[model samples]
Structures are given as structure tokens and as C-alpha cells.
Target: MRRYGIQPVASITDDLDIAPLLITSVGRLLWRYRSELAPVTMLALLIGTGTILHSSYRLWWPTVAGITALVAGVLLYAGRWVNLTRPIERAYAATATAFAGGWLTTSTAHGPFTKPLPLVLAIGCVVLAAPWWAHRRRRARVRVERTLAAWPDIAQAAGLAGSRVQSAIVDLWGYRFRLGLGLGQTVEDAVAAVPRLESALGSTRGGVRVQPVASKKANRADVRVIETDPHANAITWPGPSITFITQPAKLGLFEDGAPVRVPLLRRHGLFGGVSGAGKSGGVNVLLGELTACPDVILWGIDLKRGMELQPWASCIDRLATTPQEAEALLRDAVIVLDGRADDLAQRGKRVWDPSPARPALVIIIDEYAELASEAPQAIDHADSIARRGRAVAVQLVAATQRPSKDAMGKSAVRSQMDIRVCFRVREARDADLILGQGMVKTGWHAHKLDAPGKFLISSPDHDIPRRARTYLLDDHGVHTTTERHSTHRPSLDAVSVQALERAAEMPITEDAPPPSREAEKVLMAALRQAPAEGVRINDLMRATRMRRTWVYQRLQDLARTQQAEQVSRGFWRATPEKHAQ
Candidate 1:
């Protein structure tokens, strides 16, 4: 009998222990699903409130109705203050408020247990709960909350143990969070673990981007998880984003839907990529923006026989299509650079202030490698412009396949580029050549860029490796934009014109005969050797070591006698008969 009595007492103690455990488990489940059970909790609260009001303030139905109207009106009119950004969300909130207040008022006026009142409350709860359960932003916010709540485990899996989510926000494309890292952990450590973090967070490859926080705290990182690509499609050109070269040009949209603006004034830019990586399209877009600015004069060098830049010929102040032409164009650009420097020195100014009356000059060189190889003599002039052009508002924008030292004429031109835009490349090492040395190890990864028009930009303003896409300006867009902007194009400023005139009038030597005769001989020889496609007039000028007027005069004399013929619009070549003669 003593043993059995002891067993019963022990059983009573065990039962007491299990009772609290069971209650705790139940409470944990309720809290875990609180958002899903919100409608049920709200219905119960309404019932209790209605019962109390009916017992104490049964005559307050009118006051309740008035309050409901005021609340609904506020929600409908100024719902954004409460984080309701969409009109549909605001309307839903107002309707729900009016419905709940109407049901409560009726319950207060009549008995809380009235026949239709209880049925009406049940129907209203189901109707309102449906929309609340299906809202996208609300669901996203819930997911973010749960993800952050489990961030410690995620961090551990991603090799960032002890890192905690400090704050988070959901946006249209995806969500981002502020991460507080463990001791000795830096933003580089977080960036290096992006692939692991993406796996731990179940995001797609390249979806996780870890950047240093704006405050530049050592232990903080801004982690962005991209659920949708904002630059997936070819963004159409949006006319122009600037009226002057002083402002930054809007190149395209970043992955996070922010504008990729870089100051082009007084800056030399280098754009590099593979042949089909949309580098040409990027150049066209750049020209479209620059052409619209009245304070900019555009020059282009397309050694592919003007196939790429011919569409914008109306807007371009000068376009070069051959090796000799490229040389002459760069040489003239140096002349303009010198002229502007002189003007600035006269006025004691540090930089050239561009205006419609005195516009900036932008020389865009396509296939810079071709220029380096074909016009080796021009590289010295290009190097000079690259070094001294910035202070005088004369800038060079060189586009090439790869900016190797040899490809860039083994000169300082590549080193002088302040803005580097790298599109997709065939090899990983090519990214380093285009962007900088060791950029691949630093996570630029331009080789992995999946599509055309996609690029990675590096400038003084952009230090991180964020992928962006350039706007696409199709053939029709090119035509329309050029036609519209051609009429408004600004001419060469007086300073630049006077400099060229002075250069032309300068004497070659005191004893040398007139240069026109010898220059004509060199020009004719170049034309005879020119390919079937013919040579550009700029090339003739460069070969003859003369000005544009001198080259045109000789060309007209040859054409009138049928010794040379105009093969195309801006191209000339000695006639086959003249070559035989």
C-alpha cells in the first residue's frame, strides 16, 4: 500500500509538469501564426466590444457612425501617410473600416446576440479576410520578417556566423537589409560570401549583392537580394537627360532602378567589350545624350568605314573613317586643346566653363585598337590630348575590344581614362584589361555578363561592381534623334576656329617652297593606294599635311579632269584610269 501511494504522488507531479509544457507549446503555435489568425482575433475583439457597449452605452450608435466616417475619409484621402501607396489598397482599407464600424454600430443598437447580426459578422469577416490574405506586399513583408528572424542560421550557413539583420525593407524589385557583422568581419568578407549567401537564402545566382553601407562602417553591409532584374530588357533611349555637359549624363538604369549618371565634362572615358557585346550601341546612346546638349560639339572616328557612326553624321561636327582621317582628327583635337588652354591662361581660369557660345568638345573614337595600329603616328597626338585635354573641356571617349597596352599604342591613353565602361568579354582576364588590373579578383566579373547592352562601369563616382545596361537606340530612333537635333547643333566656338586658322597660316620653313605642291603629291599617292571603298577627305588632309580647304581643292581638280572620282559621300579615290596613267 505504501508503494502504490508513492506512485500516485509521483504521477500527480508528472501531470503538473506536463500541463505547463502543453500550454507553452500551444501559445508558441498561436504566436507563430498570428498574422494568419488576425481576422479571427479581430472578430472576437469586436464581439466583446459590442457586448460591453450594448450593456453600458447602447445609445452611442450615432457617435460610432460619425467616428467611422471620419476614419474612412482620412484613409481614403491621405492613406500614403500610413504606408498605403496604391489607390486599391487605400480603397480596401476605407471599405473595411466602414464595414466594421457599421456592423459594430448595429450590434450596439440591438442586442449583441441578435439573429442577423451574428450571421452578418461572420459573412463580413470572411469577405474582408480574403483580400488581406492575398495582398502581395503584405505577404512579402511577412516573408522578410521570417527570413530576418532566421538570419543567424543563414549567416552561419553562409560562413558569416554571428552576423545579424539590423533592419530590412521590401521594394518592388525585391528586398534589402542592413547586416550587422560579427567582430573582425568586413564588407569584403560579406561580398566574398555572396554566392554562399545566395544559396543559404535560396536566391538565384548573382541575385545577392553585398555593398558597404553608405556610412562606411566596418561592421555593416547593405545586402540586396534581387528577385527581379530591373535591367532585363533593352531600355529605350529617353531623348536626353541633360541640357549641358556640366551635369552628369544618364547612361542607363542600374539593377536597383536607379539612374547611372556619370559626369562626362572634362573626363576621358574608355569603353571596352567583345565585338557583339553591344559596345557600338552603347556608343550610339552616349552620342544621343551628348548631341542634345547645346554646350557640346561631337567628333567621331569610325574606321569601320563609317558603318557605325554614319547615322549621327548630322550631329557630329567631324567624323573620321580611315587611318589618315583618324590621325588628322586627333591632331586637330590637340590643336583645339591647346587653343582652349591658352584662352584659360589668358583669363587666369583653372577650367573651361562650357556654354552655347563656347561649347565643350567630345571626340569619340571607335575601335581604338584599329587607330593604334593603323595610325601609329596619331597615337602621340591622342596621348597629348588625353593628358592635357581635361582642364580645357576637350574629352576623349575611346571604345575598343580590349585596352591592352599594345592595343592602346602602348601609351598613357588607357591610364588616363577616368571613366571605364566594360561590357561582356570572352575571357575573364579581358575584364581586367578593360576595367583595370586585378578587377576580376575584386569581383567585377564582366565575363559573366549574360546579354548585350549589359555592362559594368567604374568611375570616381562608382567604385562597386554593380552591373548596369545601356539604353538601346535602334535605327529608327537614331534617324529621328539626329534629324531633330541636327538643326540645333552648335558650331565650333570662335576660340577653336581661330586656333585652327592660326595653325593653317603658320609657315613651314623660310626656304621651303609652297607646301601646296608637295602636299598634293602625297594626297594623290594615298588616293591611288586607297582600297575599293575609297579614302576619306580627312585622310587626304593628313597625308598632304594641309587643311580641309587645300584637300578639297586638289580633289576637285582631280575629279574635274577624271583623274580622281568621288566614290561615296565623304570618300575619294584616284580613278582606275588615273592609277594606270
Candidate 2:
């Protein structure tokens, strides 16, 4: 083999010691050719020397031939033979042959073959090394593959065990995991599987927890297995395909195989779930179904910049984005509720018993927590509404990410809310709080929810819990439904408005006023002297000149400001704050 120009071979053998020698030899050859360029420059020097010598000696042919060969070789190297390839090599060879032929055809004293020979050979050396470089790259890849293939079977066997345990591989954005049961599992056995897998796979420090899925069906005997990893973040459903059952009095969907249905306008309803647990989508499904009924007026509150409830704004009678707006809305709602209550009371009815003529008002809140946080006034107003709003054909559907006592409040508002919708939470305590204490024993842990939008709905009527499928509400569905219902706007009954206004104005202080100023001064002096425990609306009317309506309105304003608390329907309490003020 011509060591300076021949290609090197890549070895397939494990102990290919000759491969390095071949590479070294090839590198030396390439270096030798690179040095040959200097010889070409030396030849050019000789050509110049010869040309000068010929010029001085009057050797015209010799000088012309040397200059011509130098020019040709420079042009060939610069323009055609820069990169060594077959075409460049052929061209270089042809050019060298032409230079040699020209030198041969010329006089003996003028031949310039020596000048171009080194340049052509140098190009040839580089062209020969191309194949050796390619061969080395191929051999390296093959070695890697072979090394990987030669690994012990134990490495592959570890993954194989997990494959049998995987029930399903759920791909939630930002996370993915194999969800199923591990072998040798119990109710507690499934719980044990996670720690082992976490240890095997090296636990991530992202507060990720492994939880067991509870079986709901008692009668059916099937091998129940629930496997979840923190990596299995959100369970995404295919589309807005919710499985729900509708009845004359109630309509509901199943959450985690638990049935949650509410009676139509039966004390209204409340929903609380953490963000990304499909709270918005769940509400969308509820509203979508409710809007289909012609008798319901949809009112909504979205304190999260209005994006959540804006879609349904056109279909709804009123929508509020700020606490101030919500205050006005609740104020208006109270008015409406009072009017309806009075109308029902006049008809000897306690509640708005559903009839074909009497349509119900459904108020939906997307983020009740935000509303409560921003407007504490609205919270009390909401409490009052929830307490009395249902009797006048008004209902509420509120959803929140945090359903803690502070967010929804435990005392007044939460007690009035009858229905609960629990989604995936970070704690079992949350599931207990939302779904009731029985949920934890049933393994209805919200923290273990594998799917993003999945939830567990619990209501007073549900005998056995049923899993409810959440429906995805796209823009088109929202827009079309809103447009279709644009013509039908729910009008607040005039009677309800008047009764609410009347209720709001109920007398707060017996000494505050009567029908006129003269009688008011008499009651005021009496109150100033005695400072009775609280004021009665009836007593204020009897003692003061102010009319019943005027005295009532002033009392309501006082009660609203907490100057006095409404003790009973027509009675008021003078708080210490009121006395101090």
C-alpha cells in the first residue's frame, strides 16, 4: 500500500490495536502531504530562480515554460483542487499531466514538472483520507450498539416487572406516568407498591405522593386495582362526554363513580374544587345542561378577571367581575329574592314550588374564594342570599379552588350550601371536608385523583357514590349556546324586588325614627334615657312619627351596616359597636 495516499480500514474486532496504528499512519501521511505544499513553494522559488537565470542568459523558452506552469498550478490549486474528491483528483491529475506534457514539449532547460508534482500529490493524499475518516465514524457507532447489547439481562428485567403493573400510561402535560397495580397487593398492598417503586425509581422531591384508588361498587366482584404516581399528574379525558342521569326533580353527574345530583332549585347548590381539577369545566357542564331548560335564568360571578364566566355572559341575566359589581349584584339579588319571598308568602307558600309559570334564578360563581377575599361585604350578602334566596326561586352554584373555612366560611354560608363537589386535592383532610367524613373510609381521597378533570360529587340524595365524567366546553359550544339564548333574558319579578327593598329597609332602632320628626324625637329621647336592648320594627312604628315603610328602610340600612343585627324576621339587636358608635 502507498502509505502516503492509500485509505485506512476501520476494525470490527474488540482488541483492534492495529486501528490506532492505521489512524496514526494515515495522519502522518496527511501531515507529510501538508508539508509537500512547502516543496511546491520551493519549486516556485526555483521556477523564479530559473526564470531569472534564463532571462539573464537569454533563455526565453525556459522562462516562459516555468512561469506558465507556475500560473497553471496556482490556478488549479486555488480554483479546482481545494477539496480532495474524485473530480478534483481527476482534474488535478489531468492538469499535472498537461503541465508535464507542456514541460516535455518544451526545451530541456525550461521544463516545469517539478513545480506542480508536489501540489498534485498533496491533493491526492487528502482525497485518500476521506474514506478512512468515514470508516472510523461507522466503527464507533457499531461499537456503542454492541456494548449496549452486551449488558446483563438484569437491567432489562427490572423494567419488565413494572410493565405488568402498569394499568395505563396517562400523559398529562408537564407529566407522564404508568398507572396500575403492582403484584402482591392488598387494599394496603397497593399502598405498599408505591414506596417500593419510588425507591426503585429514585423518589422525586416535588412533593409527589402515591395514593390508592378506592373501589366503589360493592356488589360486583372484580379484581380492583388502582395505581397512581405523582408523575401521573392530570388525567385528561377525550372530550365533553359526561355521563349523567336526569330526573324530574334532580339532574346530576358521577364523579369518580360517585353520583352527585341536586334537586331542581332545592336550596340551590355549591361546588368547591382546587384549580386544574376541572372546576371550570365542571361548572361549564352544569351551566350547559341547565341553560337548555327554558325556565332557568343563569346569573354568574367570575372574580378571576371575568375570563371564566365571560363565555356564558350573553346567556346569563347578569355577570360581575369585581366585588363592587358583585355587591351591586347581590344587592339587586336580595331585592329580587325578597320580592319573590313576599309574593310566595302572600300566596301562603314558603318556597318557590316549581311550576310551569314560575322559572328559577340560578346564580353561578366560578371563583367564590376570590369573591370572598375581595369583598367581605359580598360574603355576608351572599350568606343572606343563600339563606333566603332559595325561597324566592333563586339558587346559587359556587366553585372554588380552596374550600377552606376561611374561603367559603363555615358558620353561615357553608351551612346553607347543601351540595358538595370534591375534586383531586393534596390532602385527605380536604376530601373529608368537601365530600364528608365518610369519604375517607370509602377511599374517596381527592389527593389520589389521577385524572385532571375527574371529581367526586356528593349530594344529600346519593345512596352510593358514582364517578362523574367531566365534559370539555369548547369556544364554539359556548358561543352558539350564548347566541341562541340571547333573545331570552330573565326578568326579575317586580314583586320580588319590592319585597327585598322592603326587607332591606326594615327598622333597626326603635328610637331612630317614626313617620315624622316630632314623634321620632319623642322615641329618641326615650331610647336615649333607657337604651333598650334592641329595637323592634313594630315598636318603632308605634312609637315614632315615621311611617312603617320609612322606619323600616332606615332600620334596614342600619342592620346592613351592622349598627344592629337582625335578630329575627322583624326584630333587631343593638350590638356594642352600634352603642359605641
Top candidate when judged by TM-score against the true structure: 1
Where's the lowest-lDDT run of ten residues in candidate 2?
Answer: 167-176
Give lDDT per model, in order. 0.87, 0.55
lDDT of 1: 0.87
> Which RMSD does model 2 reach against the true structure?
22.1
What are the runs in model 2 whose C-alpha is more than 4 Å off? 1-262, 355-357, 500-581
TM-score, cand. 1: 0.81
> Model 2 lDDT vs. the true structure?
0.55
TM-score of each: 0.81, 0.46
Model 2 C-alpha lDDT per residue in residues 133-218, reported as the tens digit of each score: 44432344343333333323312332323223222221211121223433433333333334343334333422223333334322
Ten-residue region with minimum lDDT total, candidate 1: 6-15
The segments of candidate 1 whose C-alpha lies over 4 angstroms from its true place after superposition are 1-16, 45-83, 97-121, 508-546, 549-581
